[model samples]
Target: MTQLVLHTHRQEHILRLTMNQPENLNSLGFKLVAALRASLQEATRDDAIRVLILTGTGKGFCAGADLKTMNHPYAPGEPDVLDCIVELFDELRNFPKPVIAAVNGITAAGGMELMMCCDLIYAARSARIGDAHCNYGIVPGGGGAAILPRLLPAAIAKYLLFTGELLPADKLQHYGLVNAVLDDDQLLDHATTVASVIAQKSPIGLRRTKQVANEALDKSAADAIIHERLAARDQFRSYDYREGINAFLEKRKPEFKGY
Candidate 1:
């Protein structure tokens, strides 16, 4: 089967993108990253898809980059592994619709970086998460240093990076990194439910909300408001905006065509 599988049958508007490699814990080798990026790009162009859930098959969500594969010298004209990682994260963070991480198992090093890119995360109770780069005398090049601190307290983030110790899902959830910690069997179901709920909302509203909120993370409060105002003004002109208003006044569900 393909290393990456994009499933749209579970719901009309929710796309479930799964890493199909269970061996080596679905490591982010060149092929896997390339495959994932392709799928994300496809989702972006497909208006029918409004939400995404990223997860892995078997026991791991992603165990970072496949160091064995990465150990080889880069061929001439080939992008480095770090470059692929950066590209992947950029796509994840900038994805217009909400993306949820359904972490199933061992999540470490670059694996943690992958999970951090999602808008929300729900992990199995037995999942372990952390930055393990320091343990191997390496530092993270996948935005772990920058992203972890934003998701967790500075002190806690520092400890994880300095020690390379994996923490249980419950611990990270306490730090507000993981949105929910659930039994292994419940992880995907909960993520699906959340994605479905989000998919039911106005696509125009969802896109604008996501774009503005993500931009707010990097801007001053004043700048963020200015951005939001501009985005809202544009959104108010969309067909979905009129549909939403008409649905509200007519007491009916909006049939959003994602315009």
Candidate 2:
């Protein structure tokens, strides 16, 4: 992939999507946003890609929206930068494959929102997170408002959004925003390791599992259970399920055929 803004690399069914524009602290500008959207959509259509990894090059992951673009002339709903972020959130949330966020440094405001969109997030111990939008006379137009409350306690979400204070990765991990925290140098390694395991799973199983989980997040327990039962029964009849069970009985790794 060209390094204009986003770089996508695929190996063994794992796609690592790196945010370019390291010189700009990986800010999401128009070109960068467009590049990312295109690359993600391309990966989405590839049936071989079972796992998606989101990270950034250089010292920082993403600082926020491009300050320069903030002043550019624009028309009504003419594909604003926030639109790009919303698109990304939708992609990650709806992706048939599992999406993991690997954050190495500060990821405030929109960056944090992007991180939150991932199915799982791993961060460097020193990485930071915050809703810096309040400091800029704005609010999170991304999925921040909707997701933070789900990831964290309602009171905790209120304090963070209200104060907009930056918190270290450890704190966020305790708050459930981050799945885990590793050494700065091991951030991507941990992310890739987890993604690799996910990539080895049956694609049909993984996709249905992700969809069911995402859909059940806001559903009642009984409703979620009903959906889960239906999903499990449907997937159990697929060829992959038979392979999985036979492989288990034979004590061999199953060769999943994405069915």
Candidate 3:
């Protein structure tokens, strides 16, 4: 089976991207990284795709980078692991649509970084997530260092980074990072519902809102206001904007064509 599985629910306009290498805990090896990148590119190009739900199969979400791949000597034709990681981080950060993380079991090290980058994270109550880079006598080669501090409190981030310990999903949820802590069986269904609700909205509005929200933290309040105004103005020009207004006035649900 492929390392990555991209299943498109065309009717819902949702794409479920599963990391399929469960035997290796869906490690971020060259194959998995390449497959994920290609899948994201496909999602980007497909207009019908509105929301992306990222999850993994079997026992673990991802066990960070494949030690086997990293330990092996590099060959002339091979892509650098660092390069692949950076590319994946960039793709996740700039993915136009909302990306929801349905985190299952054993999310650690770089896997935790990947989950943190998503717009929303819904975790299974039984899942364990943390930064375990220290355990291997190495630090994060990915964006973990940069992103974790931003997501978590200084003490919490330092504790995880320094100790390399896994924390239960409930603990993370208590920190207000995870959107929901759910039963294993309910994880996917809840994520799908969120995606379906978002998918029904105007695509341009969602994209613009996401763009602004993602960058808001980095911008000044005045700058964010200006940015949001510009985004709202652009949204007004979209066909769906008019459709939404008309539908509201007519007391009917808007059928967004993603224009």
Better of 1 and 2 by lDDT: 1
In model 1, state the lDDT of residue 21: 80
Runs in model 2 lying further than 4 Å from the true structure: 1-3
CA lDDT scores, all candidates in order: 0.88, 0.84, 0.88
What is the TM-score (0 to 1) of candidate 3?
A: 0.94
Q: For candidate 2, write residues 1-259 as lDDT tens digits.
A: 6566777787788999999777877887888777777877888789888899999887668878877787878897687777777886687678788999999787888888878878999998878888787878887888667788988999988777888887898998887888999998898889999988888889999888888899987899999999999989998899999999999999999999887
What's model 2's overall lDDT? 0.84
Model 1 regions lying over 4 Å from their true place: 1-10
Give candidate 1's TM-score.
Answer: 0.95
TM-score of each: 0.95, 0.94, 0.94
Comparing 1 and 3 on lDDT, the stronger one: 1
Tell me the tens digit of each residue's lDDT in model 1 across 99-138.
9999999998999999989999999998999999998888
